[model samples]
Target: MIALDSIIGTLNLDDEQKFITYLQKKNKRKDAKNIDLFKLLSKSTLDSKAICNQLYQTKNSNAYHALRKRLFQSLIDFTANKNLEDENSIDMQIIKYILASRTFLIQKNYQVAYKILDKAEYLADENLLYPILNEIYHTKIQYAPNYPKINLEDLIRKQKENQNKHQLEDQLNIVYAKLKTVLNSISHESKIINFEIELNDILKSTDIELNESLSFKSLYQILAIANISALVTNRYYEIESFVLKSYEILKRKKETNKQLYYQIYISYIIANTLFRNKKFTSSLNYLKEMEDLMLLKKGVYFKEFILKKTLVEALNHNYTDNQDKAISLAETILKKKHNDIESLLDLHLSLLMFYFQKGQLLKAKSVLSKFYHTDQWYIEKASIDWVIKKNVAEILLYIELESDALLISRLRSFKRSYSNYLKQIGQTRILKFLNLAEKIYKNHNYLTSKTFKTDVEEAFERNTANKEDIFVISFYAWLKQKINKGDLYKTTLKLIQKQ
Candidate 1:
């Protein structure tokens, strides 16, 4: 026992090291089984992320990246190999690819993502690729359909092809110009215009089938080729009568894949025209229908645009009373920014009017705080949106019997600042905004109402008389009329007369 203890305690460093080396050598000699066990890890773990992490942690970079790639390959292989009961199961690979592409897009590695997405797209024969492909196409469509590298051989061939394309394009263009020329041509009779005559013949014979037989690209070429198009030249009833024929035929013929999409744009255009004419209710209904059919989140070009549309729709849907969803939707927009100066200002002023009318001063103050973020918020940048809030506030202020001094002062000061900005921009015509606001603030029911009504008659009367004015004028004229008949105008008149 004494001899053993002394040997252990007083062992030399070399002996101790030699002893450890002997043990390590013995341990290293025998583990084909453990290597086999490690090999089995490829089957043991199906979690792609976990496998990737483990591989990296174990100093296997090549294996880690390989496994990462195999995850996608595995999904596609599974979809291909397995006899799946669910279509969604087959689409799992597509989902993975799309999500991965989005991740790369979010990382701003566009080329890599685009290449990967293209591969994914080729693998996919489904229509789900349309939205993705459309986005990818748009990223470069302005400069060229496909670019960054154009084949010299193809370029030479295309230049030769372009010679023929130019001839065809030029002929279509000449015909198209003839249609445009008809709009400026003075005509009192609906059935007697030169443009209408040409348009009638085209409508009678040409259709998707006839156009196809002539090797033309559907409505696009015919729309391009017609010497005189009726859309611009005809006024409300006449244009509607012509357009409705096409619209009815299109609606009844059983829609193709993209027909619904065309309808969405058409509805949007019609809604825009109606909104221009101050047909807010009609516009709201049209927009609601279009939105119901739109691509939802997938179609949102930007967060701001979508939010603004939703906010306006929410506002436009209700009359006399403000909806709570407008505020919530606005708040949703605000959370995406570091206060979101533009949206906050819009929401603030909207509430300032809505809450002030409802007599909820506290709520109005809370809403106005959102607009305080911008040091110099420019209304021109947000012209149409700013107009809605400012005008609405003026309407409320004019009508409210219990108008707060602070609120009136702030709104009036804003109007003044906006007027100066308008002057500076050499858009003195926009000074009408101040004039309208003044009437609203002063509760000039008759004057504002008169202006508003005339605005509508000008904007909405279908340009039957060939009088084309802008949307703002029509919008303002309509609002003025509303104020005159509104309870606000009545209340204001009572107060003014008493004074």
Candidate 2:
């Protein structure tokens, strides 16, 4: 039941309509209830038992379960057909060519078979479709003995090269999987581990080179690994040059239409990396390029990357003193059904931060309430780092509301769960911030005391030579405003400017 709802929820309005139309064509009986079940699941409002009651109007679990199975199968068929029709058009063309060439080969039409295979091989080579190319090469080699024009040795050599590329892609996929596992471990495990070293070791095992003649998809994976590593380790500044250089190289290549998806994603990674490094203008510039690229192919990839592009833009605006713009942008995304759960959580948290900085406690709390998922759910969907940030923000919001009971409970839960992990990561400043907040909760007078102010200063002593992450500074400014009794928004801006 949950799986059905998840699939239904991912479809947009046009897709929903297309699925309905498809069902209309495929349903064999007027009494078929798969469409009804689909509609109920699409709304995502009721439990399976309730849905069964509504659909059957009786205790008929057998009929209800069978209907669900039918509806689920329909969804799978519809999505698979749509993907081949839309996203895999080039692959379909290549497949058709291969099939047509095989038919000719079987008929002993060697001249026409070679010509058809030539077309297939050309299309595959243009797109670096290595697997398809291998198939085409194998077909040629099988007929090499009968065809005097066939270069059997050259065909074998090309087949070997294609196999190597495919193997490299497989190796990179393993590295990507390893990276995700390590990141999840960092989020969930209490054991101390240097994520940067782990990432480097996994990447080194791949022995992949930036300048390797890899497919665009493989290159995108490489950039994604670097971006995720930088994100987790706060090494955006270190990877900024590498990401930018890779994008530049990609742009210089005469990429085919098939490579546009990877190209757009690579640009997004570059934009996000720049944003992390506080190069707001440059980040926005890259975003503009990404947006233009998204316009290609009638905006097929636009919806795919809209959340990410908007999130980066909003973050840049928020840090640039355009919180209203940021809030407006973020609010627009929340009204739609998006499968990008991680980005949705990020947008919600950003909205919470924006409203919190404006001292709009009610609005901040409203945004915070949208995070209704469990900690385990968030950990699985988002990350442990995001969960920690959300927890801290909730504590601060409760404190500002003077909801002592809720604040105390939340503070205790956060400390119990993350204190040692934070200490392991050398983030004692966050622990100190919570401590000061707790002190203020106990004795409001201490919030403005000189001794408390000095403690805050000492706890968050800034290294003037190194710029702080804008988000770190934002959290620190909240504590500063509590002591100075100043505008939270202004204090945040001041700290950002100083950085």
Best by TM-score: 2
What is the alpha-carbon RMSD of candidate 1 to the true structure?
21.1
For all predicted structures, in order, the TM-scores are 0.36, 0.94
Best by lDDT: 2
- Per-residue alpha-carbon lDDT of candidate 2 for residues 1-499, written as tens digits (9 for 90 to 100): 4378777889999899999999999998998888888888887588888988998898789999878888888889898988887768888999998899889888989999999899989888887888899999999999989888988899999899999998998998899889877777876553567888888788676677776477788888888888778767666778888888876666666664657888788888988888877888999998999999899988878999999999999999998889899999999988887878788889899999999988889999998887888887897888788888999899989988989888988998889988988898877778988898789889978876898988888877553323466677778888888877799999887777775
Q: Tens-digit lDDT track for model 1 on 388-477?
A: 345545434444444557546655665664555445433444455445544555665645466655654443333322223222332343
True-vs-predicted CA distance for residue 348, candidate 2, Å: 0.5
User: Least lDDT summed over 10 consecutive residues: which range in candidate 1?
Assistant: 210-219
Backbone clash total for model 2 is 0
In model 1, how large is the Cα lDDT of residue 154? Answer: 50
